[model samples]
Target: MASHNGVNRLFGGTGGVVDGHVHLWDTAAMRISWFRDDLGLPPRVGPGDLARAVATSPVPVRAAVAVQAADTEGESRWLLRQSAAHVPLPGPVVLQYDARPTEPDAWAGMAQAVIDDGATAPGVAGVRLAVPGGAADLSDVAGLDALCEGLAATGRVLETLVRPEQLAAVAALAARHPTLDVVVCHLGLGTGEPDASWRDALAAVAARRRAHAKLSGLFTTSRDDAGRVAAAARAAVDLLGPERLLFGSDWPMSARVAPYAEIVGRTAAALPPLDDGAAAAVWSGTAERLYGAATRTSPAPRG
Candidate 1:
């Protein structure tokens, strides 16, 4: 229930506008828990306080998939509990648990728990992983094959965050496990020749047709690095096409990188020009179909 000059607008209708890969982290747990104690991955993310970050805007995030930041199932559980509490204005919830090949057996069991809770609850949708060579080298071991087999057996979608350099290997993984619906996060790193390698990666993923790419984390590619990543985004939409494009804020991660709205809004605005309906697909429409949130229709009110 939203209003514009006293009438509902932003949160109305059948349009399932969503940032496909937005992350939700709260101060409920020590931020260090998000990273590894031994690996020292984050300086100190500290218990992330995210609600205020999402407060101002009417971004009714119908469904979001948080990636496994290379840890155990503990973080995933906390996120689920957080999702269960919010109501009405907050919107229904769901999450994607992170999986790593290092602990295949443990990751498998964690996947089951996530599905058992998420799939049945209506908000939880799939499991997330870092594709070989994208984050960690895929050529390192037979881990990907094992992860795929497990996901195929369970009928879960696999979300992957890959660097442009890792596209070929990712393609092979997708081909190897055709049964799994793969979500490629980050528009395959940024676009442009300076990083054309990543763009080629996006092209490779799009060629598979089974692959889906998320327009998330531009802040990682730009702000902290270069400048606006719209050029990179436009390059991806050009190669991958808006049909396969999905929007995401990358949330808490963006807290230090970019405001949630800034990342999502700028990416949406910078998307390669799409004919009316096509733009909606990248911004929210297609996410509804693949993530399965479309079935639960909600009203969309204009801001």
Candidate 2:
């Protein structure tokens, strides 16, 4: 479809815009992870296309976080490599990998491999897991819980992909590891029954304050229903406040839905306006707090 994203109207605020949710994929490297030909999404859109959108987008987009899809280890690993190789990208724009739970007996041992590789991966800020999706690694409970437990042990935030109703599973897991930070993706997602289960889940996260929510991907999940997404985004901001709200672009996944500019624009509008500090927090500081990404080293005070 032609990119008729509603960016300009929603464009507000002069400070930098940080998109909190997007995904990336390269079809040539491997099959598009989330979309099988059978599931029938638009032709696979990749990073090149997203870069184009970011460059030409009407909104004042300064930075964005690109996440990983459930499938395609190549895409996930490639994103990590790109994060390390690119000199100017200035991120903690990360690759959140999918992880499987281990067999009951072997889980304790296997956790180290996944956690070690992810933590040591060149640009892996953290591992990303979405329930009911991703590889065989995450497709089952025994497997997913195992991975969650391990990531929790390592203190990597649990990047959870959840629909509102299904979020209880993550909540249960979060309950187990009070210390683990859970960054919930897509506002608990949405489908035929999008509702307060998201509110409830956010409450669950808030209670522990061991969680964060990426205020992104509304365009993909809601798919042009800008009003509803805007409303949901506001509620999330109201509940989580600017401090706990992080941005993501949900990129390659957003292709068939809308551009990053529109996603960011709509999400920005939905939330209450921020003062300078809160604005800084949502734009980047908050992510810095959550991800441990290094800030710029100032030039030495030289002669």
Candidate 3:
């Protein structure tokens, strides 16, 4: 059982922490290509599990933004339903939909349709697309310009799951659409060992005022190097500042490597020291502002 006392002490006892990124899925309900039976994770992971994990963790997660795990509209709808069911594990649970189109020409229409559909559901804060190619490849993607325009016009975020090599493209994309809120997941897929190229590319992304990064998924690259992870985090803070960075646990997927508590604790430890204001921004404030989560409040903890 987790208590909010730690959060209270950390943030002057007024607000709770927000997990900027998390994933929940049911292997039986949908097809998650990367999730396997041998991965040591249960077939199903839901908000209840997140609640329990948060309870045990040193940081009390008041709200969460559920990112898309499976590339399907059904999974997005399922996440919204789950979020609606679990009002406040201390706060609100919102979600991002996968709006990637199978055909490049269909992107604009697909994005428009998602925005139209999401208007009725407040939980749909943004959309995510996996960018596997380089900067030139992204620019060549048909209807990408319109997709970014539409998302920017609608004030919906555009979260990209990009590879380390493609980070410069993401930065350019953000520059092209200044109004669109762009978030880079998993610290640009950086590892403990510093790469000058990765740092330079990340710095470019940070230069964009509307661009942000998630301090999550360090284990994926530097599983055994906590010091390396901390160093990377410090560099990110120096590059993006606390206001532009958000804390994400990347749970369930990260559960494949470490427990929820360790994930959150390690991320916390890796960060550069900050005053209360900066710490709150990284932990929750920035997420609340970026995702419009401030209005969503919880009466009490439930697990």
Candidate 4:
């Protein structure tokens, strides 16, 4: 058994560490249509595969919350099963539930599915809804609200990955679901062209206390600009505070850009000075709060 205590021991006893975002896919399962054999990415990444990967992490990953890589319910179910089995993830596994922005009924159905299958599941954390590239649409506000209301009822975090220009729309959705914790992935897509609006939009969303930020994938977006990544980390800490910030690997996708360990090392190096408790919050505690993983404890990993 890979105990939670095992990971704590790995990081020199920094206590429990949680990976806020992890993506696991099985190409053979036909879940990842974007995957091409020509791309030369791994054909599959299951729970055991993750154990190997995280075993190499600079810090022991006591628990990892996985998000869906394929846009399918099968993928979500597969992750939940993995979590139920305690397969390398002490999870609040975030499942991918796709609902068209214009379709509120569709959102309602998807949200209900989460409540039905995942709401009370110990391994399930909630859902991640992907916002396609281009402008975001809230024209279906009622539908979006239905999806959020369902999520709030289940106590799951609503995670979204949106471009900079689409952030205001995200903030608008957050406003509609004031009680829901909406986590903005990749620092509001801050990795691209230098845009002042990214910072402004981030500030706007940060003003919403229920909004949270994940410090991952920024290096890939910033083209590995260490200085820029560092500045953004500091700025996010300034605006959102350490309690609202969480760490994620954005793995496999990030693997194409840099080693997983480097991503972890760099993110830790980039953060602003924080007290021990505050640093723990960014590394693991905040994620626990967002998804209700605090009381779930497991044994340590083996040597």
Q: Which candidate gets the maximum lDDT versus the true structure?
A: 4
Candidate 1, which ten residues in sequence have the lowest lDDT sum?
Answer: 294-303
Q: Is candidate 2 or candidate 3 better by TM-score?
A: 3
Alpha-carbon lDDT, every model: 0.54, 0.56, 0.70, 0.71
Please give the RMSD of candidate 2 to the true structure: 7.3
Provide the TM-score for each candidate, comma-separated: 0.71, 0.73, 0.84, 0.84
**Across residues 101-202, which tens digit of lDDT does each residue of candidate 1 receive?**
455454443544554443333444556665444344466533456656655554455676666667677787888777766777776573323266666666
- 238-270 in candidate 4: lDDT tens per residue? 889989999998877777777766777777767
Per-residue lDDT over 190-273 for candidate 3, one digit per residue giving the tens place of the 0 to 100 score: 443557877898899999999999988777534467777877888889999998999888887788777887777667667766
34-63 per-residue lDDT for model 2 (tens digits): 567665454544445556777655555555
Count clashing residue pairs in model 3: 1
So what's the TM-score on candidate 2?
A: 0.73
lDDT of 3: 0.70
- Give candidate 1's TM-score: 0.71
How many clashing pairs does model 4 include? 9
User: What are the clashing pairs of model 3?
Assistant: 2-55
**Cα lDDT for residue 148, model 2?**
54
